[model samples]
Target: MNTKIIKLDINNKMYETITAKQGDTKSRFLLFNLLDGSIPFSLENRSVRVYAVKPDRTEVFNDLIITDAAKGYCILELTTQMLAVAGTVRLELMVIEEDKKLTSNIFYMDVKESINSEKAVVSTNEFTALMNGLAALSEYDIYKSNAKQVPGIKEEVSNLSSQLDNMITLKLLMDIDSTNYRINDFIMVDKITRLQNIYMANFLRNLRNGSPVTIACMGDSMTYGHDVNSEDKRSADTTPCDNGSRHSFTRASITYPESLQKYLNKIYKNNVTVINRGYSGDYVKKGMERWNKKHNANLTIIMYGTNDSRADYVPEEYRGNIDEYLKWYEQAIIREILWGKAVVIFTPPKLQSFGDLDVDTFANGLIQLCKKYNVPYIDTELFTINYNNINSDGVHFNGVGYEIFGMKSASVFVSENLLKPQYVKGGTKLLNRQTVDNFVVNGTYSYSATSGAYTPSELNNTGGSVLNLNPGSSITYSFYCEEDDMFVIPYIYTGADKIKISLDFGLKAPENSIDASIGKGATPLDNNKSSLEFTNSGTLLINKDEVFTNGVECLRIPTKGWHTLTLTNEHSQSTGGTLVINGIEFMNYDVFASYVNINKYYRQNYLKYTSHPILGDTASVSEIRIKPIDYLKLHPFYYLANTEYWRNPPLQLIITDYLKGSIIYTFTIGNNSDTTMFHGEKARLGAYTGGRTVSNITLDNDTREIVITFNSGLTNKSNLLLKLV
Candidate 1:
């Protein structure tokens, strides 16, 4: 579900409007980021109350659930009565403390009418209690005024009595059976389930597409493969190995991460890199900090309770309670989910000679938290109990034991079909092409011999200033594409010498040569061989005069998600040939537009505050020219001022037109005094858009709108169709 996150400033009185569909009781939610000016308000030890006046002037009050206290994040699940009327509802929040209250300026919620038949509103216990308390207060006020014979007090009591009577009647009318409402109306189970499912689906889809998937094994010494070898045993003061940062005895390939990678590669013909983020003597708190520092993995296998279970391993904040430590672990899991990662929590393996450590309580608490958040978990204690003599030191696993544990850990992913493509109920949508330059910010470059490699240098060619690679040097790029049949075109400046080209699916070791059969399930352009390998037998030879050109259609990607492509200088140092790489481009195959289906799903699942077109239609037109204003129309949510209310702004936007092609635009927006206007900001066109080219962008100060002029004449706006997506 695409949840709408709204950031509101308590000090500012400018009203911001959010929207909800009528009768949306469970799926729609408003996640509010309460702020004091620009800083997040401290929600610690504070209770938040939401008072809303419906379009019909009916009032409803409830306490909000604080998701992240430090970040001042609270969530309110829309109820039936809250969205009953199809008009504006005034809302206000009050953060109450022991001695004072911080009240927010009134905001508005525009509820759009839905087609579903309206049912009788259901009143919650909290609402009933609130009404009862208010009624009692009004009666008390009347008694006080009558006894004192205050002149204006009597009139005030009469008005309060009238309002209290109306409130009581409304409460009685809404006191109906709530069995028809969704279970999610009372809890956040469905929301967590939906988020987990989406993450899992995307992960599985990438895995099936032969994309590079990285997993981080995060835990204590057990995850570090401690005692795997007698000499590899780490002490309490040993430095932690985070994503292979520093080499140590425990950082050997015999670790569980290596075992996991080997097991996964053996089972599935795909590249899976597992990073060991295990620190010796680390507990849940330290693990949370480490993971937060660097969490780029698609899946993180967390097993940190063993160290946390130690008798003396208690933080002051946790107060020596195992349940508090478990809460910390749950927070880490929630962080992973919020970061868009598929998480798997593993109960710490059984300990042998550890004295007076409450491992059982910690593990049990973890299991309960996993269930609450709908996270997948493995009971490692049970699995370890079935094994014989797996532990070397009572605490850490031996080599054989680590291997077995790692192999078993991979079973959950396979059994759950997390590495397999799912049959989603949607039409196939063609995505815009993705491109990567030689100087890709995140690309990794390595050389067998660094003496000949230049650090900061560029080779001027027809394609532009490109990076040059000496003999035995290679560069690897990791990118994400939506379509499986995308073609990869690597532009190279083939010098006078005959430079051999090789295409590898992922980053390859120096000793390992390119294998044409590596991509088992992938489709190659050539009938007899895989597209991932380009040899002299099936190579596209270009003349030296054709300086920088599309060298070859090297590979056809089999699936979508994150993919790694390596371009190596396939020459020995003795040969001494330079490889000039311009860039690489991923092009999509033409197909019918599935924007209609995508839009329908968005409207049903997402809050309709702003209409941001997700995908464009490509029904019949052969060519369509799209301008900046066309893009604005396609992405009104981001182009409009309402996007400032979003907690996280979009980094990239893909717009497709009826021409059966799309352009990916990437841009960054800075703080604007006038939130409605995006002036002097430039968006980079990062993909191929068939025939159309956006030359310049100019903003009209009068209208506070973007006016785009193309190299070609803008005579036919009808022919310049822009996609909603």
Candidate 2:
């Protein structure tokens, strides 16, 4: 055998390409002396793996022979399969150690074709056997009779032979241990474990029982099904749409969640509903907020970290450290586990032409956390790095990529036994409750302006039409209210300048108005009284001090009838200022109050958990109460008073408390016609004092109310915090 040696430094680039003849397979060998700067990197007790990408996009994964481990030397004996391609092969060396792994810079291998090379022909034994069997069948009397009746039998037999050949070829290509050059070797799984499959016990049970299962696929744009369809596609330079910006472009039919649903239902023959709760351009922190709002899913698959890899995505304190940066994800996983719902985390693929964040390190950190918490995770880096999967933007995936992802995800669920129930916990009954509804009137809707004209501008962030209000113009919006005491909020976009706002055109007097600029309610402007003025700071500040940054409240509509609210831009014609109105949001006072209360509670108790000396850490005691209006606020999109959009019912609040073995938690509910009601039988009470038990569950049929009380006792230093789901 002919031998060739190549010395390559790990710190510098390799300018020379290793050249070999295409047909010189068995007699050719390449030896590599790996050096770190001026010193030879020790390879003792380490494994060196070679990764090569062939000219036809096929991949080769093989280990190199370590001839001198102490001297950092390895040898790669060229094979007929490796030298079959007569083009440049991109190769890299990965040295794996017990604690760490190091990869060398990518190098090239150019293989020249021989002058008189000829294509090699091969035949399989299976094909020969099948042909012999068919020949033998022709000698039988039954075969002769059938062949006389069917004139196209010969063609059909030929077609069957061709199909068999194709199938065999495909099976050979798919085999990971094939000595021949194969395609799709990059799609192989590196790790497989089912230790954390127990977390999905309840979800699996639901599927087995033929009960409806809701799976929430939550992440950024990838989970939102970006680039899967034509409408949502973007170029390399185009910025990804935010949460509500591209809601209309997202097609639920083609998303990965939908694909997963289709695959699962086809295999399991069960009812599975997958909702895409994906918000584009969102980091983990924002994802946590959105999930906290409403994640009433039996299983939640979270795939984030793509947008978080942007240069400015993470906080300064969280930069560089993967553990600190992924704190939000850790907390989210823990919350889901505590809520008794199954969770599957997906580490996003590395960016091809996008941001420069170290996704590999981040993914490794996530895997470590997943192992530590005993949570299942799907590492999508290897699955999506191919050119056929990623889109032109290099951040999102194409339809094929999404489909493959969905299929593989379904396969994982089946292969890992995640669909089999291990420990069945009784299902918690969801409460039936009525939530607040909201009405919105676009700026281009029926309205009259005095003095200057109202020209329609482009749509705003919420996808509502915007009307640019000319200086010195007063626009009066006449909208009817269904109930009394409904609050009206006018969405306005004001440029930097001091603008006078006059609200004296309504028939009824203004009850109260929040002056967001000053962060307080201005004195009520009586009907035909004075106007209020405030300066536009041009910065959106979301805080308790000023909740409505782009909108001002006109609280308390005295009657449930037709009402007109007017806003007059007091800027002179020559002053040159802009006041753009997007739309008006009219919500019931009680509903608005509830929305504020819920939002406030979320902000106060956000990621707040209770820890005891003996009881350990409990899930967040915060309540997850959100109405349709709240969800819409988080993911705003264009819609009028459509009942389907506005009437999506809110989730029932379920409070959980982890107490000491001897302590008992009592939840009292009054049996009043106008009070809150609950299903006493559905209440889940687990006592750790000795064994799990539901002590007392009382219900009042007349009042339609219920009270749940567990075994009573208390232990010192027991955490009594409660969590509302």
TM-score of each: 0.34, 0.29
What are the per-residue Cα lDDT tens digits for candidate 1 across 1-725?
22466778788875667888877754555667777764567799986778888877777776665666765777665666687777898888889877788889998889887776356354222362265443243322343336463345334434543443332211111111222322112212334455777887777667645678888888877787766456545443254443333334343336677777875664345478898788666688766655445467897788877767663654666535686687567656655655667777888877875464577667777766776666776666533432455667667777656766666555444422233322211132211111212111112232222223222223322222445566555554434344444555566543324443332223121111123332311221322112243333233333212211222334544444333455566553434455655455554422111221232223221111111223243222222322222233334333223345343233333333333454444333322324332223334344434434445443333222333344453222223222332
lDDT of 2 by residue, 368-416 (tens): 7676555666666534432243353566666655665665455444322
**Candidate 1 at 265: error in angstroms?**
0.7
Model 2's alpha-carbon lDDT is 0.49
**Candidate 2 TM-score over all chains jointly:** 0.29
Clash pairs, model 1 backbone? 209-559, 613-724, 613-725, 614-725, 615-725
Model 1 score (lDDT): 0.51
Q: Residue 43 of candidate 1: its Cα lDDT?
A: 95
Model 2 CA deviation exceeding 4 Å by range: 1-199, 208-210, 228-253, 311-321, 353-357, 385-390, 415-725
Q: What pairs collide in candidate 2?
A: 661-689
